[model samples]
Target: MARNISLNFRVVEGRDLPAKDVSGNSDPYCIVKVDHEVVARTATVWRNLNPFWGEEFTLHLPLDFHHLAFYVLDEDTIGHDDIIGKISLSKETIAAASPRGIDSWLNLSHVDPDEEVQGEIHLDVKLWTEAQGPRLRCHIIEARDLAPRDLSGTSDPFARIFWGSQSLDTVTIKKTRFPHWDEVLELHGEEGPLRVEVWDWDMVGKNDFLGMVEFPPDVLLQCPPSGWFRLLPFASAEEDAGGKLGALRLKVRLAEERILPSVYYQPLIDLLVESVLSPAQDDTVTPLAMLDEVSSGESRQDIATQLVKIFLGRGLAVPLLDYLNLREVSRTNEETKADRSGLAVVGRTHLRQDLDLGVLGYKSSSHVTQGFSKLAWCEQSVGAGPGQVRTSIPVCRICAVERVDENAFQQPHMMQVITKNRDGQLDTMYIQCKNVNELNQWLSAIRKASVCNEGMLPSCHPGAFRGNRWTCCLQQDRTVQGCSRTHSAVTLGDWSDPLDPDTEAQMVYQQLLLGRDKLRKKYIEFSEEKIKLEQEVMKGQSCLEEERSGVPEQERPPTATAAAHLLAVLEDLEQAHKTFEQQEKEQVARGSLHS
Candidate 1:
């Protein structure tokens, strides 16, 4: 199965970048990479310690990619660009964020060459006890896509295998990233885990470490393991810059899956239909229920996804989900109901404080009083002996509230709230808070109050409109669309997305295969009944297939056709399984061969 991920992110700004030029500032830019391949680059900002790009990109990436990286570099006209620092987000880290994703300032870490390695190596290993004693054999097949170590951008790579105090080295393959060195090394009476390390064989100075892989002694107990194992850097202390190198403000979100077209899923769909339509002798002993019972919590989610897709393909998804939800709601106890009611009341009161006529006081250099229904501010007169004048605007008229750049507004902890008056004119309010936390609270409260108002602003400038241009995006027109994505818009449609049945079904099938032996052992006493059930199911499936094959496609009976489809799907699945098994055998044979 093929997997994909859609990544959307914005490189908002960089702060406190180190000086790389003699003029006391760095001309900085960012390069984005998926795995080791560069995907995007931002334009350089000249002569500034702090730079704002406000650049956003949406990329489609393979799910197997190891990491996403941002390398910050300082541009120099005289020599090569200086590497400032880098930020690397691993696949596991990004996936943990899930539906909400990450939005924060990430500190950059200094790069180390020996710690930055990529690629995989193929190996075959076997251990057995002979009349003489115990013996071990390891076949190092080949390595591919190792990191470039030489200045010419290619490494002379070789593998070193270690068992206990003894070690063996393979012949070096020079001047190539992908090296094919087929060699087998044997060890006798060695009683430790096997370790394999790949290195760049440089004649001058010491050989550079590429990557390494290790296998426990227990692995030899199974059939000789053979496959491509990913290379990893030597374990070291965690890299930290302590915010001195600089920080990148980034917003990243991962899209879970990219589904194929409906045609590609027809076979899986047929199998699901057959499972649903087949008659069962026992109501509680259906295939799905049995699978669910044996499945782990994670695998159960995969099964549920498949079932949802199958129902959606048949146009019954909404009704099925609604029925399930209704059942859950009916099962809720009185205590749960009371808890939910209390939460709802709290939510209502929170909104009421924003929409009612309650007066709230905000202290600044000047005394400011605000009412919930309308914002009212009283400015104390300085020379005119404390004369007070009040100005008010309805809270419902507010559309957008966004953080202002401290440099642009020349004030710390400032926010801008935009509103539309009854005359259709735009009004701007600049509010200064005591601190960042207060500014955030006011922004949240104002946004929640006018969330349902008509004609709410879709986007607003994070930077002020000055010198006939927007500061953040440098757009000359003040009315141009906002450069940054808005966070206030909420949609419920994503909760109804259809899942891929093929991936889910494969996961469930693999789990069942793994547990087959245990299941057989558990029901050993019921072998006769199990055999009888299997024979009946196979006989019925064969008869249905033969009956359908004998009839014309147009004249086939509609009542029992699902059985025929199921048989065909089963045949296809069996062929696919055979093909995979054959491929694995071939790989193992190739890995075991000596050059």
Candidate 2:
């Protein structure tokens, strides 16, 4: 089976980096490599002890990968970019973690002790959007005690910023132990996070990490504060406050619009369904594979479950199952062949047993046979041995078949087969089997024969098999010929009919209805929030109008200030109302969609 491999790499910000340049702060950027192949590179944040790089990448790889490595390097104008430090994760280590993928502060490991790579990189990663539509703004102000990689002790440094796949770089500052970029990067997207990194400028090799940092949408939106944040070591290490390692001063904020409607999910699901219908030649490109890549944390499973529901909604569950089953079959070719061979051997063994006529059913007089039994059924319709009688019942006439239980004076395995005659009259006969398993096989064969012949058998009433004659059949008019057949001397057993797909599908559909309740709750909450926001907006507008009208009698400047405040409040209320309305509309659409 092709295992789905989801890899998410978020290069947030690094801080408290060791100085690599002889001049000053080392210019630093991150290099991400899968196995031995380089996949991504972060722009350098220069001349600062603490740098922030808010970059993220999601990759869909096969299970064949070996290792994932992250390298931090310092850029020098004259020499090759020097590797500050590197950290790596083996495939086994990653696979052992959660299927949702790991998100934590992994300490950067170094290859050489002489090269000190000190700092912690912070990242914020999760699945889906944090808001409907959000704008992220990051301010890069200054850095202290940056790793210096230059020969002159003072190093030229620059800063780089990343969000999603896009990247931006700051102009280089020459010969500065402390460089202030005071740069701001603005981005708009379905809410996520921003990555920022600082690196010392190198005309020759590579820019190295001074520091790095990351701001997730939620954090930025909730804590819109500007201050100096302490830069920690790149790799896990002991702490030092105001010594060699320093801090970074910057600001970040996130602005988001109202939530989008759930109706928007239809297109996404349609795309996924389309993928299943026509799977990609490359497993990595399949919709499910992409889904695994884009989603992270708890939302990944929710998204997958919702997609399944969507597939069911479109009446494609069976096809999807077949597609998945095909994949499974392809993966187990050798096992399937072995199973086929095993089945053939078992089939031949059973075939020999079936030809042996070890038992027979016959009618007896006074519950006891004379010397010869009447109305006998045998494997050979004609006399197979001396004094053996032919069976009048034909296998083609058999209709319904069932397994019967064993009781006192009866064998443990027994079955009953019902057959119809040319005149529409039906006869039921009981037969014994070697065991329960053989009984089930006999019952199946009889039922199949009935279907092949398209014969309709008479319904057997509860009292139909009383003693030697069918009591229910005898209850009819005297003109009717009641069936004169002996009931099997065995107790009836219990067996369920074969499964019906339509009925089973309905049962599954009922189980999925639970998700609807959650959606309805969300809808109600969104509607209430929308109403509250609208009311607030109205009240703010009314207050503004009242203040304007009273401006003539009050201090003009104070009235203006009060009016401005009301306007601002109304604006905020309007924005909030818009967001809630969007959410409510989506909820309603989703509720109606399945219905």
TM-score of each: 0.45, 0.25
**Candidate 1 residue runs with Cα over 4 Å from true position:** 1-4, 258-595
Provide the lDDT at 164 for model 2. Answer: 77
Query: Weakest 10 consecutive residues, lDDT, candidate 2?
Result: 489-498
Write the residue-wise lDDT of candidate 2 on 395-496 in tens digits: 556655654323211344555666777887777666556544345444443443244356443333322343453332223333343222222211111111
The candidate that achieves the highest TM-score relative to the unseen native structure: 1
Give me the displacement of residue 585 in model 2, in angstroms. 45
- The clash count of every prediction, one per candidate, is 0, 76
lDDT per residue for candidate 1 within 111-223, as digits (tens), equals 88887888778899988888777788989987765777875556789999998898999998776566668899898876778889999998889999999998887876665
**Candidate models: Cα lDDT each:** 0.62, 0.46
Model 1 TM-score is: 0.45
- Name the lDDT value of residue 484 in candidate 2: 23
Deviating ranges (above 4 Å) for candidate 2: 99-101, 112-595
